[model samples]
Target: MTTTSYRTAEQIGHTEQGPRPLPALGVQTAASQPSLVDTVLPNGLRVIAVRKESVPMVELRLRIPFAGMDRLHAARAEVLANVLLTGTERRDRAQFDTDLAAVGGDLSSVVDPERLSIGGSALASGMDVLLDVLADALTGAVYRDEEVARESERLVERITMARSQPSVIAREALQKHRYGDHPFTKEMPEAAEIGEVTPEQVRALHKAAVLPRGALLVLVGDIDPDGAVAAVGGALAGWQSDASAVSLPKLPDLTPGDVRLVHRAGAVQSQIRLSAQALPRTDPGYAALQVANLVFGGYFSSRLVENIREDKGYTYGAHSYFEFTKDNATVLVEADTASGVTPAAFWETRYELGRLVLSPPSESEVDNARQYAIGSLLTSTSSQAGLCATLVALGAVGLSYEWLRDQPMRIADVTAEQVAEAAEKHFAPSRFTGIVVGDADVLAPQFRAIGGVVLP
Candidate 1:
């Protein structure tokens, strides 16, 4: 209904329209890459500063490889991240918040089995204060009893809620099935065990996991690169420790095998999680593999989404992508469906997987995916926040902003034949393994008929 308007249709300029076609090729890339200042502090902290000069803000990212010493380390690190910024010897929780607010900044910390990462931003002029506050937290976090108690309880509550989620359940099952006793399996810790962590253990964990030797700090903003790097050296010069920074060893290659059934009795939906070994970003043909994934299922326009969602209505969405760890990479394919249609979705996913190798993508498919991959990379790094985060990953692999800026041209150079080869090598259905989470009585018999299940 129009509400006292001349006419809604007229205002909106209504007209019949048809879908538009994608544009032809263009030499689109980042206009120019940011100039960079890279250096290492005496304390063994690698600082990478990029001169973005777009806005008066600086984004900071610190990556400390927080690999757990053992299974219990994962639980302790969880609690540590939650309470890390809660208080420090120089300031209580409230004071800490006030100081950061003064600098137009906020900081947060999180830890996985691979790394303990701290990220935040501040006004460019207030960069010194930001660094000071970060240094304070690193050097003198108190982990007071009351704050630890409160944050631990909150962590438990959050984890409890997360565990109840079907997606989380599926992921947990997949990790357990894939890596029975691997430290990587500790990515998601048990909530009950996490809640039992004490303040002293958190202190010990901070000491062990947060060493600066070989750690990386990435800063991007409107600033002079040389001065910025030198400033960082002065500010964090004291963040030294005799202990080496934590790092994970290489991940074992994935071997395709039978699907493990994780029966969720009486569930209304099932989540299919499939993964296979993949190439790291540094590997040759990785750019082609990246494009190949996009053509298969990495984007909404890909074959998997076209078949499973738009054409057949098996699920609301389906996607596949690569996950890079510190040591290795894995491709993940996921889709959620009603319990009754679970088998159909599974069949189509496997069929798509097999077809990728048997038939391969067309020239059009390869080009479209390449364009998207390039456009996304350029756009994502176009801002300070984006570039700051990008630098950390790049830094981890001993790459730089120059490499990222050149990636679009590198991607455009990838040919359809290369993508096809990557598909044949990596996308073969026989090269995948996974688990299905649903009602056993309903799904068990169906899965068994398809093969790859042990009879009870």
Candidate 2:
């Protein structure tokens, strides 16, 4: 064999003096707008269709507000989502799969405290079949006893396993600490609740909660926009109802206080979760706040990551991100570290939060973060699936494609002074409250000495 020569990674990366500087970002070109139709059908469903033409497949997303206040509502909703695609009036379970497989189509259903969402894709030529099946399920799904029982058994097992995970335990503690007794905190039903869910309860919930009114359906693919909307209107004509789907109750504003320590016995690792209320996407200052969040811990190059992961060896990963709910929003910071180093990690996290406000991000730091925010937005929506999902989220909050197309400009306009202002107004260590979950025996003494932490 002939020998081949290659430069080593270190040789390519370094010169006599140092590593090479990265190339500057090129000017961003605006994407051409697609043909679109946004209309409310006679049956009250909002259908948004766009001609992306990037691939020969179509992506679908449907969102229905499905919140409730009853104690067993979560159990019923879980069982309902799991068994939604099992069968309909016209097709049995096998027949449903056969029809979908013939068109290279598949669908999945998932529910949270806010909404019941269904997402799927199919070959462009099979869009009609896909819509027909979806409409059939929405209008006439029969939650047969046997199918409900089987799915409930499987869900019980999954929920049981999930509740045992340290992440899940920490999340439950954080939710309770942040928003106690709110229906929004009922994200996962207890395993025993699943056993009590009956076929009749699932059927009743579908009848009362899965209405067409106030629901949104988004379709994007290689098809005519107007034609797709017309097709959707025709397929879903029979799914009419007078009552609107229920939206989740508004969340209470978070109260900042001492961090609570939750005891997880025998756990070798610990989770640190913190939260603070922030502006919604609709707020004028949201762009500046977004940049500030990026500089703090939103990305790998953030100060929190550099200080804790790169310097202190505290954790393998850390991140900060916005969690949006309807018109409300909050910024959350999360890091997972070893039990032995948990207190140090907590101290560093608060120190960085205060530092972001006191010594605001520099001009270079703001520029890098602004560029990342704009670049990530464009990259995420370049694909048809991503576009469909993004539209669904925007649509849920009374927005549309215009807001998406205009976001890059919004981010580009944010100045360093604006970022500083946002950081000062939002990132104060006193404006946050959360939970530190680990073995109390291991974490108590160190956290007590560190202060501002409530013991078990």
Candidate 3:
């Protein structure tokens, strides 16, 4: 084609693939990683501080381990998170909101089986006020009856809607398949229990589970690390408790087994969620396995998406990711499809899983995946919000700023052979147990033909 005949991408932007294979990626250079200052206050709270002067804003992340004694605990904890900021002992809900808004700040709370997280942000100059407000809430949340009642009703409505969704049903069934009756399997509480919860129960949970002994706080912004630490230490001096926080117990290793068919009565679609045990970030081979996951199903250009979505058109989307727990991690794959095509989609998924382990990915595939893994991390951490969030997660796994700074080089150095080895060890179809949530009448016959499916 001559230059005169060529058209811009706006005119002809489709099918950029060439007839020949693409070249492998070469070495990558990155900007200098940021410096971090960290300290553990005498009260045993870990504070991580980083100076990012690019923006005049500050970000805060706090994670506290929240353990429940029984299934009822989930319901109570959910209510507590919803109302923790509604009314402190001194300020009413409206006043608290107004004060935070005055400083361009906001705080929100989220509770799960693993932990209770409080994420907030403010202007750089309002940093001290934000910390003071957080300290006040920690020490003196009132959990008023009227506020609790209102939030409780709203939570029940939200949960009921969530429980009816196909994705939620599939996720709940998958957790059950993996962990049986473990407390972690209960993602949402029973609506009836949530309705019965009183304000008193929430206060009790707050007393028992919201201690600061094992909490992690990550602060990033355009502030001096030394002064920020001192300010935080002074503000939170009274937010201490004698009782130690309870961390979740270590989960048992994932065992590969038969597929389970969960019958969703009269459903027109199916959700397939599958998983296998995976290495944690601390593992020596984790970086390579991350690259391997990207090549398999972690990205749009992956082999799994190519075979299942683009080629076969079995589903609109398919995604696989790693879920990290305090004790371990697992690889998860999920896709939803028409009820009639569910069996074909599941078959292709398993076939791809087997093929990933049977043969190594091409050199070009390895290079693309490796670069994606490295590049995404750099882009994510360039902002204060992103860096602080990443810091909170890394701290949960006992990693530090040095680890985050070195990850790009580690990912860039991963070779095709390393990714292949990690794939063979972790991606075998036989090593995964999965669930098919759809009409049993439509799915049972097809799943039975393939064998290894247990009916319930």
Candidate with the greatest lDDT versus the true structure: 2
TM-score of structure candidate 3: 0.95
Model with the higher TM-score, candidate 2 or 3: 2
Q: Write the per-residue lDDT of candidate 2 for residues 1-456, one digit (tens) a residue.
A: 999999975578668887544456676555567899999988889999999889999999999999999999999999999999999889989988988888899988999999999999999999999999998899989999999999999999999999999989999999999999999888999999998888988999999999999999999999899999999988998898899999999998899999999999988999999999999888899999999999999997799998999779899999999998996799999999999999999999999999999999998899889989988898999899999999999999888888888888888888999999999999999999999999999999999998999999
lDDT of 1 by residue, 62-114 (tens): 99987765757888898889888988878888988899999899899998878
Candidate 2: residue pairs that collide: none
Candidate 2: which stretches are off by over 4 Å?
1-22, 28-30
Q: What is the lDDT of residue 184 in candidate 2?
A: 89
Across residues 195-283, which tens digit of lDDT does each residue of candidate 3 receive?
88999989988888898888999999998888888988999999888777788878888899888999999999999999999999999
How many residue pairs in model 2 have overlapping backbones? 0
| Number of the predicted model whose TM-score against the real structure is largest | 2
User: What is the descending TM-score order?
Assistant: 2, 3, 1
Q: What is the lDDT of residue 364 in candidate 1?
A: 81
TM-score of 1: 0.94
Query: By how many angstroms RMSD does model 2 differ from the true structure?
Result: 2.5
C-alpha lDDT (0 to 100) for residue 428 of candidate 3? 93
Q: For candidate 2, give the lDDT.
A: 0.93
Clashing pairs in 3: none
- Per-prediction TM-score to the true structure, in the order listed: 0.94, 0.96, 0.95
